[model samples]
Target: MPDLQLLCLSNPLLDIQAVGNEELLQKYGLKANAAILAEEQHMGLYDDLIQNYHAEVIAGGGSNIARGAQYMLPPNSVFFIGCISNDKYGRLLKKSCEKAGVRTEFRIDENVPTGRCGVVITGHNRSLCTSLAAANEYKVEHLKDPDVWKLVQDTKIYYVEGYHLTVCVPAVLALAEEAVTTDKVFIFNFSAPFIPQVYGSPLAIVLEYADYIIGNETEAMAWAESQSQSTKSIAEIARLLIRLPKKNKKRYRIVIITQGEAPTISAVAKSGGEIEITEHPVRKVPSDLIKDTNGAGDAWAGGFCAGLVQGKTLYECIDMGHWLAQLGIQELGAAYPYPRRTFQPSKD
Candidate 1:
C-alpha cells in the first residue's frame, strides 16, 4: 500500500447541536437547513439552547470532519491546519478529533474564543448559526511556521476547503502552486455557494492546480455562474470543470457534482485524451432516517480522498464517497457520534 498523508487547511470549529422546532427557528430568524455565519453575540443564544435544550457538543468545522472520516480514511493520515482559542472548547475539539484518529495541527489563538457553531435540528429541518471568531484568525503567517512548513513539504496530497478562500485566498493559492511544482495531488472542494459566487478569480487560479474537485448542486451552480457559463444544465457544468486546464501535465483531472438523494455526476480526463462524463446514483436514505445533513458533503470529500490514497478505481472512490455521506446524514454533528464503526470496502 502506498504511504498516504493528506494535509487539510480548514476553519476549526466546536459544534453544539440540539433538536428544536420551527418555532425556535422563526424566533431566531434562522432559515431551516441553511448555514450562515453568526456574530459573537450569537454565541450567547447558542449557549442558552445548549444549557436549556440538552444540546451535545461535538467537534465541528470542514477540516475537523474531513479529518473525522477516520472511519473511511487511514488512521493518523490526515493533518489539519486551523486556529482555535486556547480554551476548554479548543481542548474538546482537539480531543474529539484525536479520539477519531485524526492528527491535528492547530494554531492556538489566545486572544479570541474558540470557533463554535449552534446546530438546531427539527423534523427533516436543520439550521446552523456559526461564530467564526478564532477560526477566521488563521492567516498566511500560520502556514509559515516552521512546523507547519515541514508538514507542507512532507505532504503528498493537499485537501482544501473552499471556506479557506474567504479567510486566506493568497495562502490557498500559494498552496495550490506548491502542489503543482512538487507534483503533489491537489483536491479542492466548492464548499458553499458564497465562495464561488463571491470570490471567482482567486478560486479559478487555485483550480488550475487541482487534480480532483468536489462540489454539490448549489456549489456547482454557483461555480458555473462564476465562470460566466449557464447553470441550467448540471452536465455541462461537470464537463466544464473536468476540461479545466491543468498546471501539471502528469496529473489526471476529475470532477464530481453531488445532489442530495439523487445521482452523482462525474467527469474524468485520462492522459491520452480519453474523457468520460457519466452519472453515478447514490444509495438513498429513507426520508424518516435522516438525522441531520450538516456534514454530509465534507464526509463525501474525505471518503473519496481516502479511496484515492489507497489506489482505488474511480468508481470505487465515488462509492466510498456516497457511502460515507449516507452515514453522515444519519448522525448529529460533524464528527459522527461514535468512532467504533468504520468503513469496509465493498466486496462488489
Candidate 2:
C-alpha cells in the first residue's frame, strides 16, 4: 500500500446545531425543512431557540471531514487547508482538529471574523444557514507558500468541496492542475444541490479535473439537468457522469453516485473503451437511527479517501464509503466514534 497523505482545501466553520420540537420552530418563525439566513434582528430568536432545546455546537464542513479522516486514517496522514479568524470559534476549531488527530495548516486572519453555520434539526430533517466569513478570504496567494506547495506535492490525493469553487475558482483550478501534473488523485464532493444551479459552468470545469467524483442522488440530478428526470436511478446518473468528456479521458477513472437507503453504484471506465457499472449494497444496521444528516457526505468522502490511500480497489473504496456513511448518520455530527482500522485487501 502506498503511504497516504491526504490534503483537503475548503471552508471550515463552527456549527451550532439545535434540536427541537414544533414549538421551537414557531418561536423562531423558521419554516420546517428550509434554511433561512438569519440576520441580526433574528439573534434573539436563535438565542431563545438554543435555550429552549438541547443544543450542541461543533466543528463543521471541510474541517469535519478532516476530523473524520483523522479518526479513520493513520496519524499525521490528514491535513486541512483553510482560513479562520483569531476568535473563540477559531480556537475551538483548532482544538477540535487536535483532539481528532488532524494536522492543521490553517491561515489565521485577524481582520476577518471566523465562519459559522447554524444547523436546525427537526426530527429526521435538518437545515443549514452558513456565513463563509473568513473562509471566503482564503485565496490562491495563501497556498503559494513553499510549505503548502510541498504538502500538495507530497499528498497522494487532493479533496475539494464544490462550495468553494465559485468563490475560490482560481485557487481550486491551480490545485487541480498541480494534482494532474503530479499524477495525484483528485476527489470532488458536489456539496449542496443548489450550488451547481448557480455556478454550473465553473463546476463543470472543476469536474473535468477530478479523478473521482462523489455526490448524493439529488446533487447528481441537479448537475445532470434536463438530461434525466429527478427520479432517475443512481446507476443511470453515474453512467451519465462517466460518459461526460473531460480534459484527459484516461485520467477520470471512477464516479460514485450515492442514494440514501439504497445501493450505491460505481461507474468505472474500462481500458477497452467501455464503461462498466457495479452496484454495492449497503449493509443495513437495524438499530441505527439518524440523528443528523449534516456530515454524512463528508464522512463518506473520508472513508473513500482512506480506502484509496491504502491502494484499495475502486469497489473497496465505494464499500468503505458506504460503511462510514452508515456510521455517520447514527450520530449527531460527522465524526463517529469508531476504532481506526488499517485497510486490509481482504476486507474489500
Candidate 3:
C-alpha cells in the first residue's frame, strides 16, 4: 500500500500522430485541438497515414498524465485501470505504459479491438479522431476484481481526467468515494470545454469528492457558463469552485486554473477559514521551444499530483506543475523526452 502514490481510471487509446495540413484535417472530418469519437469506418484514414505519412504511434489518453507523473515520481508510483482489446495493440499499450513507468491493470475485451487516436498535427495544432472500440466498452465491472481494489486501497492520492465521467461515472464515483471514505487526496481536472458543457451531471458527481480541481481558462470559463454564471472573472470563478460544497465537510479543497502563458490562479482555503487567492505566472516559451499544446493541461495535472503526494505546499505544487508543462510542451507528444524532466520546482 505504501508503494502507490496515485491511482487513476481512464479509457486508454493508442496515439498515431502525423504531420498534415488543414486540408488533410477537413478530409478526415476532425476539428483542430479537439478529441472526437470517430466512426468505425474512420480507421481507414489511419491506415492511409501509417502507410504514407510517417505516423508515430504510442499510448496516449488523458490518463497519460498519471503516466507522466510516474516519470517524475519513484518507480511503480502510479497505477492505471482501463479497458483494451485482447490484441497486439493492447500489448503495445501495456508495453508503452511500462516504458513510461506507469503500472496498469487493464481489462482485456476479447470481443472488441483496442482503441486508437489518429492525431493530425497541422502546423501548430493537432486534430484528434479517436475510435474507442474497446475503451468505450469499459465498465465498472472491470474494476470489481479484488486485486484492483487492493491497489486502490494502497493509494493515498488519486488523479483522473474529467473525461472518465463520460465513459463510466460509476467508476469515477468509486474512486471519488474512496477519496472521501479514506480522507485521501483526489485531484480532478476538467479535461476539455465540452466536458463541463455537455457532461455537467457526471462532473457534478465527481466534484463532490475532489480535493483539488485543475482546469485551463477555457474549461473554467465553460464550467462557469454551465453553472449559469458565465460572467465571473477567472479569479472569481476559481474562488467559487473552491467554495463549492464537498461531500466530506472536513476536507480543505483548492482550485487551480492555468491560462497558457498568463499567470495561473490558485484559490486556497486557509487553516482559519480564510480563502487565499494566489496567482503564479508562467514563463513564455519561445516559438521554437513550443512543440505542441496537446497535453499541457494533463502534464500540469500530473506534476501537481506528484507534488501533492510528496507533501509540497500549494505554491510549490503550482511551480512544479508549470515546470513539467514547460518540459512537456517542448516535446512532440504529451510525454516528456528520454532525458525526462528533473523533479524540481522553479521560483514562481
Candidate 4:
C-alpha cells in the first residue's frame, strides 16, 4: 500500500438509511434532522428499518470522511482504524473502504455484532440514531501493536472524531501526544454537540493538543457553554478555541466553525497574541435539489483535510470542504456522485 498521509480514528458504523413516515419518527421520539445516540427504546429500530423500510447500508462515521479524502487524494493516502465485529456488516464496511481506495486496520471482536446507525429519513430531513455496539469495544492495546504504531508514525496528519472519546480517550490522547511530539498536524472534530456537553473532561484535555479544531455551530456553542463561554458569539468561540493552552508551541491553532446554509467562521492565532477571524459564505444549493444531510460534515472534513495534505491555502481548503459537502447533500446519503466532479481552485 502507498505511504499513509492522513490517519483517522473514529467509530466505523454501518449506516442503515431509509425513508419513513411521521409514525416511525414518533415511535422513536426522534426529531426530524436531529442526530442522537441510541437508547434502550431504540433497540429494535435497526431491525425494524430493514424489515419495514427500504434500508441501504453504507460505511459511515470516520469511513465517510476517509472515503471523501480518498476521493480527492491518491490511492492509499488515507488510512482509517476502528473496531468492528467479525460479521458480514464488518466485511461489508471493509469492502466499502477498499472500493473507495481508503485503507483500514480494523480490530475484530468475536463477541459483539457490528455497530450500526439507523438513518430515518423524512423527506429531506434525516434523524440519526446510532448504536455503537462492537465499535465501542476498541482497546488502546490495538494501537500499541508494533505494526499499528508504525502506521501512526508514518502518518503526517491525524483526524479524530469526538465520538471516539466515548469509545477510547487514551488512544486518541496517544495519537495527539505523538502529533505534538513530532510537530505534526492534529485535527479534532466535535462530531456531535453532546460530546463536549457530556464528556467535557476528556474533551478539555484533548483540545489542548489539537492544532486544528472543527465543529458545527451547535457543537461549537455546546463547547463554549461547557468552557464557561456561553455568552460568546460563534466568531468569539473560534477565537477562544485557538487560544487554548498548547503543548507544542511550534504550530499555532486554527478553529473552524460551520453554520448550516450560512457562513463558516475561521479563527487563526498569530504571534504576539493576535487572532485573525474570517467568515466564508456557504455555496448555495437550491432547496429543491437537496437530498440528505447525514454526512455533510464528514464530507467537509474530508475535503478540508485533503486540501491541507496537498498544501492548499486555508481559503482553498475551506472551498474544497464546501464543495464536497455540497456534493454529498445532492445524493441520497453521505456520498459523492460517481465519475467525480473536478475541483479547480479559483485564482481570485
Instruction: State the weakest 10-residue window (summed lDDT) of model 2.
Output: 339-348
Query: Residue-wise lDDT of candidate 2 within 1-348, one digit each (tens)?
Result: 334388888898877678766776666567668776665644554344446665666778688777776666777888888889998778877777777777778888888767777667777767666666788788787787888777777777889998788568888898888887767788888887877777888887888888888888888888877444565667877877887766655475689877777777789888776889987777565654766666777887888887887787887877777777777777886658556544333242
- TM-score, every prediction: 0.91, 0.88, 0.93, 0.93
lDDT of 3 by residue, 113-188 (tens): 8888888887777788888888877788777679888888888888877877778888888888878888888888
Please report, as a residue range, the 10-residue window in candidate 1 with the lowest summed lDDT: 339-348
lDDT of each: 0.80, 0.75, 0.83, 0.89
Name the regions of candidate 4 deviating beyond 4 angstroms. 22-36, 39-44, 346-348
- TM-score, structure 1 vs. true: 0.91
Over the full model, what C-alpha lDDT does candidate 1 score relative to the true structure?
0.80
Q: lDDT per residue, candidate 4, 1-348, as tens digits?
A: 677899999999888889998999999889988878898999788888888997887788789999998889989999999999988778877888898889999999999878888999887688899888899999899998999999999998999999999999999999999999999999999999999999999999999999999999999999988877856599988888888898789999999999988898999999999999999887777888887676789999999999988989999999889989988888988788889788866443
Candidate 3 stretches with Cα past 4 Å from truth are: 21-35
| Candidate 1 wrong stretches, greater than 4 Å | 1-4, 21-34, 337-339, 342-348
| C-alpha lDDT of candidate 3 relative to the true structure | 0.83
Instruction: Give the range where candidate 3 is weakest over 10 consecutive residues by summed lDDT.
Output: 339-348
Top candidate, metric lDDT: 4
**With candidate 2 superimposed using the best TM-score fit, by how many Å does residue 51's alpha carbon deviate from the native?**
7.8
Question: Compared with the true structure, what per-residue lDDT tens digits does model 1 show for residues 10-117?
Answer: 889888888888777877788888878885446575767777779888778866545645566667877788889999889988887777777788888899988888
